[model samples]
Target: MSQKRVLITGAAGFLGSHLCDKFVSEGYFVIGMDNFITGDSKNIAHLTGNSNFRFIEHDVTNYINIEGDLDYILHFASPASPIDYLKIPIQTLKVGSLGTHNCLGLARSKGARMLIASTSEVYGDPLVHPQTEDYYGNVNTIGPRGVYDEAKRFQEAITMAYHRFHGLETRIVRIFNTYGPRMRLNDGRVIPAFMGQALRGEDLTVFGDGSQTRSFCYVSDQVDGIYKLLLSDYTNPINIGNPHEISIKDFAEEIIQLTGTDQKVIYQDLPIDDPMQRQPDITRAKDILGWEPKVGRAEGMKKTFEYFKSLTEEELYKSEHKDFTNYHK
Candidate 1:
């Protein structure tokens, strides 16, 4: 059988790079695209010499023209982290809106299936615990984090519109807080933030009294769920995350234990519109895709700690101080 050609946007990102590796290893011809706004080439550097992999530097918001009979398109391009989208708000909106639309068009033209990477941010600061896909989110459209939340909401809306109106084959995965190797150390997401600080022997910053809770999905499990969703016949959005929940304070303490650092947990004011709790109701995913996270938090954190430890002292220092420089100024 001929290998399917899979094009993944934001292919240099944490999740994107993992997807690229998964697809290529499964014998798919993988083409990765990224503008490096939040993604870096170094994330996908390991695949540079692979015969089954190719890389393209392009923004998904721009016209994405590709040749050949593309088998699948994984639209993972977006400024995902708070620091990233907050710094480039308009770009975040554009990638979610324009970028998704462009990918759908490409899918339609090539007669290929497409899976869009949506986020749990679409849930906003939820009024419900263990958020299910059926729950309508309580999103603040004009809040500081609205750019990312509403952008993803709009991405889902337009994607469904394409599926219904244009008969385009589409799949949407609502990704939860995922972490592992290749995560950008300065992305301002909680795991990397805690790990980077601990590596440098700095105080771990926990926002909002550290009471907020979240479920962290390991990257490999996330990639598996996404791949299954893309190949499945389901067209509606499905939540893909570990259902286990942990408080921010507990998470920080765990990292402290894992890294064996003397760093203490410090409380900072929570950012505006930060979700107090986020745990995905993955019943739909489990029933439909037969997938759930296999790695527990402790094991996942151990693997992640080893990855961070492999970085040079200078790299770890830069990651730790990068976010603080602007705050001090």
Candidate 2:
């Protein structure tokens, strides 16, 4: 049989690039799409010469075009970080809405299975302790983070609609705090923010008195879970993330220890609508996909820090003192 083909939006992003690599390794013809709004070309540069890999420079918010037989489409295009979405709120909303619509249309035309990258943010400042797929989120629709939160909530909604109405094979993965290599150093996510500060010999910034919690899954495990979800017969949303939780204060200390930095952590008021407790109940993923994170925080952080340390002096120090006051990822 001929090799299968898959189109991955946000191809140069941290997670998307990794997904591209995964699909390519699985012997799929991969077509990666991105406009570089927040994605960096370097993330996907290694695949430049691969015969199975091709790239398209286009924004998914606009209409998408794919040639040849396409077996899968993973709609991951959007401003995933607080800084990116805050800077381009409209684009974030458009991609999650209009961009998703376009990808679904393309999937319909091509007779392909579709998967969307959803987020834990859908459960905005979640009232539930450990979020499950059935939990109706407690989101502030008009809040500052509403652009990304509502965008993802709508993404899931429309994806389900397409699955039901058009009979389009669809999967939704509600990703939690996933960290590994290729994460932009100053994206305002806690991992990169704290690590960047530690590398720069600066104090780690912990917003919200450091009590808010987060659970991080290593990138490779996240990719595996997504790969399994795409191939599984389940049609509803599934949470893919490490359930091991830690407070911001504790995570900051871990960074300091990992980097062997003398700088202390300073606390500030947490950003508005920031989830005080973020953890995923992955019972569905385990039951359906037999997926669980294999990388521990200690091992994953070491690998991640090694990658960050590989950066040049220019990347390490760029925006060294950028305000992390709003860092709540």
Per lDDT, the best of the predicted structures is 2
**lDDT tens per residue, model 1, 1-329:** 88889999999988999999999989999999998777778899989889999899998888999978899999999878888778777888988999998999999999999898899999999999989999889999999999999999999999999999999999999999999998878678999889888887789999989999999999989999998999899999999999999999998988898988888889989999999999999999999999989999889889999999999877776642223223111
Candidate 2, superposed: residue stretches over 4 Å from native: 320-329
Alpha-carbon local distance difference test for all models: 0.89, 0.93
lDDT of 2 by residue, 285-325 (tens): 99999999999999999999999999999999876333323
Candidate 2 lDDT score relative to the true structure: 0.93
Worst 10 residues of 2 by lDDT: 320-329
Give the winner by TM-score: 2
lDDT of candidate 1? 0.89
